[model samples]
Target: MNLSVGITLAAIMTIACYSYLWRENTLYRIAEHLFVGLGAGYSIAMGWNNVKTNAINPLLNDGQYILIVPLLLGALLFTRFLPGSNKWLARIPMAFLVGTGIALSARAAVLAEFVQQIRATIIPLNSVNNILIVVGTIGVLAYFFFSSKFTEGIPGLKYGALVGRYVMMAAFGAAFGNGVMGRISLLISRLQFIFGSWLGLM
Candidate 1:
């Protein structure tokens, strides 16, 4: 069967990776290392390209000196690898990055998870599906209520919390099933590629 070098190499790597499913072997280890090395090299090259085009060019050509602050901070990340007490200097940039990341992520998460989810749940109870959605949402929230013991609280809340627990279990189960289905789909696609494209036996 006719096969291009790229397709042949891809097939070999695919087989090598799948070989781990049976048992770890030298071929799988080689493929894994090759994949990691190529990925890291590509990431480094892309990062440098982005800094040159996006940051360096703007700072030098367009007189955007403020970019230097971020550049300096990024460079400080590597200082952690240096010897002695000087490694503490890296924490300055690390703390700044973590603080900003947390602030940005928390703000976005509040808007998306709290506000958007509440809005979505506040739908008209015009259908059975909408009713179930509203009930399930409330039950899930009640299950997470930790201020007071459920036994000491409102009488009906204990039952509501129980229902909420069930709802959460169902949600988790569905998520897990979906994940397994996705993995199976990937396996099917790989099998099709090996048999239909490479071997021409499908």
Candidate 2:
């Protein structure tokens, strides 16, 4: 409950979690389950608070009748626990949630991935970097063009496609290296926390 005691407890849990690096054991399993349980409890509490403020308060104080629709749909999700044919009632809410989620995701993806990417690619070909960007963008797009036969169609289509393939591979390799670097940074930070804060061996 005290600051130092809490920090010590956290350090112990961290060590228990890292113990899995050597081999699976009781300590690692206990830490993992504790983490999952705490996460679920926190999520439930946050969701409850959100619904009370956003839905219940608005309906009661602001007289917003429209909020009742979403509340009803959310309640219908629990019908999955009911017996027999009534269990199918859960699908109504589930379908609405899935459909709305897909529509929102698709809209955002189009704006961010397609529209913004194309806008960024339309740079003036003045500098060498700009020319390379243009060429790489075209080559990547050409690689995905399955309609035309790259080998037999245009004069330089085959070579353009080949360039695109290499560009994609280079992009993938860079992304992978960046991900590894980020993970290594996280590992180093954790190690520092254990040595400096927990063990006092900095």
Candidate 3:
């Protein structure tokens, strides 16, 4: 529990994790396995502790039988560790998880994605920025419309598609510029750390 000892251990672990950037070596492999082993042990211990507090003590001592179902489901998750006999028991929780996930996603998709996006697109675009958003949305939608072929009979639609292509190119250019700026910023920050913090020469 000593603060200095904990800090030293943390620094060592950080170095060990970063050592993988170099060539493969025994020290890094040992550190990797040690981390995995410790993580697995910690996860198991915490799962057992949660089950004991929420399930076993409540059911046996405090007269709460309601937790048995979830507790049984949680216990079934461990069946994957058993030999070939009862690994199928884990599928119960897996199926439950997939079902719950699908239900949650279906409920969330209506409000967050579909309704909100439609509401946003239908907002008043009286100002310049909102006008730009409206134009961008329309142009992007027009770009994806495949009713009329771009090269075939329609000239006006082709012009609209050409404008949409320009808008897409401009957006992509801005994104690439921002990405380059981000990398430059990171490089500058790392340089500052090396020169200012390490050498006091910045």
Best by lDDT: 1
lDDT for each candidate structure: 0.92, 0.90, 0.80
TM-score of 3: 0.62
lDDT of 3: 0.80
State how far residue 79 of model 1 sits from its true place (Å): 1.6
> Ranking by TM-score, best first?
1, 2, 3
Any residue pairs clashing in model 1, and if so which?
none
What is the model-wide C-alpha lDDT for candidate 2?
0.90
Tens-place lDDT per residue, model 2, 123-160, is 99999999999999888878887877998876677888
Estimate, for each residue in 1-202, the C-alpha lDDT of model 1 and write its tens digit.
4398977888999999999999999999999999999999999999999999989999999999999999999899999999888998899999999999999999899989889988999999999999989999888888888877899866677878998999889999999999999999999999898888888889
Best TM-score among the predictions, by candidate number: 1
**All candidates: TM-score:** 0.87, 0.83, 0.62
Residues 108-190, model 3: lDDT tens digits: 99999999997898878689988877777777777888988878866666677777888899999999999999988976865
Q: Model 2: what TM-score?
A: 0.83
Cα RMSD (Å) per model? 2.2, 2.9, 5.3
Q: Sorted by lDDT, highest first, which candidate order results?
A: 1, 2, 3
